[model samples]
Target chain A: MAGMRLQIIGCHSATPRLLARPSAQVLEIGNSPVLIDCGEGTQMELRRLRLKFTRIEHIFISHLHGDHFFGLPGLISTFRLLGRERPLHIYGPKGIKEAITLLLKLGESWINYPLHFHELEQGTSDTLLEAKGFTVKTFPLKHRVPTQGFLFRELPGLRKLKPEVAESHGISRAYYLKIKQGADAIAADGRTIPNAVLTEPPAATGSYAYCSDTAFDPELPGHIRGVHTLYHEATFLHTEAALAAKTGHSTALEAGKIARAAEVNRLILGHFSSRYNSLDSFRKEAQQEFLNTELAADGKVFDWAEL
Target chain B: MAGMRLQIIGCHSATPRLLARPSAQVLEIGNSPVLIDCGEGTQMELRRLRLKFTRIEHIFISHLHGDHFFGLPGLISTFRLLGRERPLHIYGPKGIKEAITLLLKLGESWINYPLHFHELEQGTSDTLLEAKGFTVKTFPLKHRVPTQGFLFRELPGLRKLKPEVAESHGISRAYYLKIKQGADAIAADGRTIPNAVLTEPPAATGSYAYCSDTAFDPELPGHIRGVHTLYHEATFLHTEAALAAKTGHSTALEAGKIARAAEVNRLILGHFSSRYNSLDSFRKEAQQEFLNTELAADGKVFDWAEL
Candidate 1:
């Protein structure tokens, strides 16, 4: 993929403030932009980042909490107001459609474009969508309400091409596609050229997993094992472990434990509680268990090249 | 009233922008703060102004448009998150209750405090609420959908007290209350003192009318006649008069004409269209028809003493 970028539009949890926003992020795989967990001020945050939001076609909501999906109605209305004609797809819990359409109906302003809803009710892992080079899967999350975590895994591509080697072996440009797909080429001498000689090995495909609004569930590591990057919610500190369990949230130390168990390459701790004035402690606590850990903030971007 | 002030949280119409927001304002009548509208980013705007929004008990929505009331659910959710226990009274169209409660239901975040909705379905002018010093009334507004204009009129108070004059007339301190209510005082020497000489004239009570998201209606002037300040929507210029009519909006010239016809002390033009780059033209155009005209901008304030 040429351009694989992850931008955090908002990262704070519970309520939005002047500087801290709720959960919202944009994951751009190649040229496709997938919105995840839109919060109340997500649109404003996107505008602040100067994002071309019209290109967004798929929206994956984590849950139906106000801080997670309250911006859906306003964003949908803005898309219609801006004369967007592309089909917009929304994936969330079963009642999301009703919650959105009710407000639109009361306003007497129906969406002009095609709006698709993929309501996920299953309490197990399920494959949601498959694009050209990536696949999206939903795994169950532990929260007060039914929630799901999304996993984006890049599909393996064809082996790397060695054009000069193929040309020197009497292969023409017309057989490049077949040669890359592991086909043998025949020369004028009637000698068979192995496909391995014409192409090099394929690069490793990367995967990203996003887990938010969940407690310290030991079962989470199985669903996102060996992912390249894992963005897990760390809403509180280890000192507030009881409160985090009561609110169905995870502590920074617990998120590190999950990252260690999953064996992910990199761990990004986000969705910090608004109570904390400084975010340095979150990183310090998570690094205790997972050395390769980072913090996610508004407008923070992580390119695939960095991974 | 000691601390009567009006703060414009967001004044632009249609879609919200980085600097320009949709319709939402705060009208502080004495110590009681009343929110005029709740746009997409009103809460953030309030935070920008450093307002203690928890003191607000009443919210008046002009219409059911997304720009008018989309922030209501988030605001209510923020109140609950902040542990607000005061009752929030919302006055709007009949379907507002369903529009708000549905989102809350889907989020599974029921408001902990008492929320009361005063649904308005009347087609004519009627009084909506009567506070200690002011009364809120609604008048019919011609729009694409059911819309109403709000008028806040300060009630007439007791006559001004002249303490020195009353004491010189041999009137006891206990008889001051009756004298201020236009009662004649009977002195201990059996002498009758006229109430007019004991009290000075009461200051003229002020009124403010908010007419937004409505087409040019000639009857609007009659509903808000002789108000001190009139805030009217000027979504378009006279050059786009046809478009303003089609969209059920008013032009700046048309708003000026209404202000002139109503004989209000001052006119405030707001809810401007995003197409206009320079707001100076709006002020110039309105001043041609109405002498005292001002433009409303985000974070602008209008104090009672200035009026």
Candidate 2:
């Protein structure tokens, strides 16, 4: 199976400044690009990065904040203007459809392509979306509004068939399916061909979990435990912990603590507050608790296979 | 009185691309900056231009399209984040207030400063706003929605007093007010002094009219007749006249016709369709109809007094 790759589009929180656009990211798995949290200038950023918008098939919106989803309508309209014919699937919380529909009505323009909206509800875990060598699941998160997180796990591959054993036993093409399924075959002379003799070990599977714009909740450890890469929000520093709690956000130290508790191999922290001009403090602060921490910057690409 | 200077911030039509932002402009009249139609990525454009946000006091929105007003919430929040204490007045059609309020509610944030909304109703004209040395009036425009165009006319200045005549007639400071009001002043010597003798002729007042995102409507000529500068929308060329009418927009030829009928000193055309890569065609098309035609490009500054 091909490994998943993550690309950071924008990571700043609240208001956009000269250095950043807003909170948006893209996940590339196989031939498809999955967008996450499209902020106000995501399309421009995509153009700047020279990414193909037509390849983006799925969009996962974390929450309903303007910084997270304000750019969606413009992007959708741009796709129509660009003559996109492919269907776009948007998985987000309720009210997203209404907001987009209202904006389109106000513009007096309708999209030419098909747009599908899947409204996610709370208390659902491991709801499979697609099962093409990987499965995408939505889990609940703690936030001021209704929110959900996503977990993507690669499915185990089938065992390879040993050609020498199969040929020697005169295995027919019809019996190859059973060999690949790890079933022992009985030959015509009553000699048994063991499943281990005919099959090799399957490839290793990897998993990545995305916990976006959520407060520090230890209960997520079980859901996101042992993930290869974990993307979490670090809106503020420890000094602004009170403000973070008040806003239903997380501090850098809190995000580090969650990564440490969840036993995630690699921690990618983003959604930084616009107040802090430099991200050096975020690295220093998060590294105090979690060693393998990486700050999310616009256009930064992360490979899951490397992790 | 100081003349009004218009600054073009964003000037793209239908959909914003990577290089272009959108259709936003700033009218700098004296010390204050009146923002017109803040499209998407406007705050970033303002930052790039290094214009002081504190100077922007009033905002005039042409319509409720996403390309016109999507940047309002971000700019408003940025102002609040920068610790602005002054109030902001936004004047637009009826649905603007609801759109802004709903966006604020969804973000779960409130502005620290006071925000006033002046909803424009249909058929309403001559609504006096700020009266420093000019007057602003909104006249009806023919568009798909309830749209209006704006006219900024410089108020006639006070008559210049001839110091020699005032000294000879023994005019008091209190009588200067009457002289400035074009009234005959009665000196302490019981002699009537003619207003013309005490004052020279005042400078001619200048005016600028903004007709954006409108169809080919000749009725606007009477409302904005003889304006010094007119910024009109030219979304298409003569070849796409049918598309312009169907989309509730105007062609370059139509814009020039409006300018010629209104007898404006100079015509500035913008809001171009994305299909035309080069703007020379629009300039040529408009100039063919009206001699004094200028293309409205991003960051182009036009002075009212110069025209």
- Tell me, by lDDT, which candidate is best: 1
Off-target runs (Cα >4 Å) in candidate 1 are B1-3
Residues A1-307 of candidate 2 have per-residue lDDT tens digits of 4367778999888778778768888887644678888888788888889888767878888788778888888888888888889998898887778777877776676888899999887656756478466678888888888788998777777789888878888877688887787898877677998889889977666677888788888898888888888989999999999999988889999989999999989999998887788888988898999999999998899886653
Q: What tens-digit string does per-residue lDDT give for candidate 2 at B204-250?
A: 77778888889898788999988889999999999999999998899
TM-score computed on alpha carbons, candidate 1: 0.97
Q: What TM-score results for chain B in every one of the models?
A: 0.96, 0.93
For model 2, the interface Cα RMSD in angstroms equals 1.5
**Candidate 1, residue B286: CA error in Å?**
1.4
Which pairs of residues collide in candidate 2?
A: none
DockQ score for candidate 1: 0.75
- Cα lDDT, model 1, residue B38: 91
